[model samples]
Target: MLNLAPELAERGIAINAIAPGGTATDMAAEHTASYTPPALRDVPPEPVIQSMNALGRLAEPDEIATVTAFLLSSDASYITGATIDAAGGWI
Candidate 1:
């Protein structure tokens, strides 16, 4: 992703990657707690997701989108290869 960034920059373009730490994707639910699966079970999905995060909150999918917007914005003109960790601080 970094290499392409420079090439794309030739045209005054910017590039970045968004790494969502841990989210409750259906694919991730296949595994159980033994795998430390990201999704929560019967414990009420809302807050349990929060406790798993370092910030004590779960990240709604759109939250990541917001960060992506910022990175693609002129405000981040000097930024590249940056990662928007929109997992609500999940580790």
Candidate 2:
């Protein structure tokens, strides 16, 4: 995106990306149910996974989508060649 954004901007096209972390999706639930670390073998994975971010919770799909919508909207007219972090403050 970084490389293409500049060239695309010349044609009035915007290119950007969103890095979402720990979203509360079906895939996330499946992965949490199946994976367990050696040290945390006996521990439940949900809390451990949630603790990976500063918010202590997974983001809803709409939360990430909101960011995406903004980037594609006129509100973000000046934004380009950038990656928005919609990670719930993941560490």
Candidate 3:
């Protein structure tokens, strides 16, 4: 994105990306399922998922949505050629 930023800038376009960690969504659920056997499906996945994150919890969909919204808003107009980490400080 940074490589093309200068060129895209002339056209009033901004390019950036977000790296979200451990978000609570269907894709995450499916990935988690592969890590656990069917016999353990009854167990809550929160604890397991939290253990993998520094924040000790998975992010809600709205949390990611908020970041996305901000990126699209004028508040982030000056932000370009960067990848925002929305991982709750994951290690």
lDDT of 1 by residue, 27-88 (tens): 65554454654453445555755667787754556777778788978889998756666766
The TM-score between candidate 2 and the true structure equals: 0.85
lDDT of 3 by residue, 1-91 (tens): 8899888988989898999988889998888788888899899866776777788888999999999999999999998898999998787
Q: Give Cα distance to truth, residue 31, candidate 1, Å.
A: 10
Per-residue accuracy of model 2 over 1-27 as CA lDDT, tens digit each? 799999999999999999999888999
Instruction: Using lDDT as the measure, name the better of candidate 1 and candidate 3.
Output: 3
Predicted structure 3, TM vs. truth: 0.83
Clash tally for model 3 = 0
Q: Which candidate should be chosen as best, given TM-score against the real structure?
A: 2
- Which is the winner by TM-score between candidate 1 and candidate 2? 2
Worst 10 residues of 3 by lDDT: 45-54
lDDT agreement with native, every candidate: 0.69, 0.87, 0.87
lDDT at 53 for candidate 3?
A: 76
TM-score of 1: 0.63
Model 3 scores a C-alpha lDDT of: 0.87
The local lDDT score (0 to 100) that residue 30 gets in candidate 3 is: 87
